[model samples]
Target chain A: LAKTTQPISMDSYEGQEVNITCSHNNIATNDYITWYQQFPSQGPRFIIQGYKTKVTNEVASLFIPADRKSSTLSLPRVSLSDTAVYYCLVQGSARQLTFGSGTQLTVLP
Target chain B: EPEVTQTPSHQVTQMGQEVILRCVPISNHLYFYWYRQILGQKVEFLVSFYNNEISEKSEIFDDQFSVERPDGSNFTLKIRSTKLEDSAMYFCASSERADTDTQYFGPGTRLTVL
Candidate 1:
């Protein structure tokens, strides 16, 4: 399993963009980087995923460099409700998942 | 969109008692997994089930833990004896295939050990 490290918390003002980065120095060849967002008292929901380069979706953007040692999750135009714990997962199959403490992104109003 | 479903949103059990957690994964998904998150801690993988057997298990999933697909629709995690340390939010996840990066999660079951 690929171990991941991320910030404990981040603050973002409403309408501002937020970026959370994760480091996975031992990422394996078959591993893929994925992010999930979790609000208090709720299960995590998938945000975005990428193997390399960059991938964007309606919710967030994933940027994985060629080295695959680190990845960033970008949230655009943050809102008050976007305050949640953001997890970065490095996985090959679903079985090999390793979710870190994640970045607690607090969107301020 | 279709979603994975877990039964008994919350459960409280005494220490040393057996508890069974049930889940219904998405219809087309081929891989199913169980994860648990202690309050204020990171989510930890427990085990993965595929082809009617376990593909991998974590050290956290010790001898007291077992998983079964009792029926076509229901997947279950059975903990033979609960401990206070076992209290956590257990989540069920499913992926369409082994290589698929997307793993849909079901609302977790909150297990309280006392």
Candidate 2:
């Protein structure tokens, strides 16, 4: 498993774009980067995942540079409901998954 | 979409007592995992089960903790002797595959030890 570091918190306004970056300098070739969004009192939901380059989904987009040392999660046209803690996880074949403290995104009204 | 479901949304128990947390994962999922989030803390993995046995477990899972899929439709985590620090939100998650598959999580069971 590779360790990841991300911002503790971020502030964004409604209708603005938000990008949360995660750094995993020791990421391995077989490891994949995955992002999950968690609301208060609920379980975390899968947002997007990428191994290399860019992967876009209906909810968000994940961009991974060639170096794979870091990845970014981009959310377009955010709303107040988009406020939640986002987790960046780097996992390999083994099942010993670890989650960081996560970045809490507060969307201002 | 089918989702994982857990029993007794909230449980309150006394210290030194035994408690069981039950969960029903997504029907077709193959791998099952148990995680806990202490108040104001990050979610930590406890154990992962596959093929009727534990595939991996974290250091937090010691002799006091145990997981069992008693039957086809139920997965349970039991703590033989609950302590004050055992109080936390327990989440059950399952995935269709072991690698790179999205693990669906269930609404957690909030356990409060008095």
Winner by lDDT: 2
**Every model's DockQ, to 2 decimals?**
0.64, 0.75
Which regions of candidate 1 deviate over 4 angstroms? none
Going through the candidates in order, state the TM-score of chain A alone for each one. Answer: 0.95, 0.98
Reported per model, the fraction of native interface contacts reproduced equals 0.64, 0.68
Query: lDDT per prediction?
Result: 0.90, 0.94
The C-alpha stretches of model 2 lying farther than 4 A from their native spots are none
TM-score of each: 0.94, 0.98
Candidate 1 on A75-99: residue-level lDDT in tens? 9999999999999988784455778
Which digits, one per residue and each the tens of the lDDT, describe model 2 over residues A8-76?
999999999999999999999899999999998788888898999999999999999999999999999
RMSD per prediction, one decimal? 1.5, 0.8
- Per-model chain B TM-scores are 0.97, 0.98
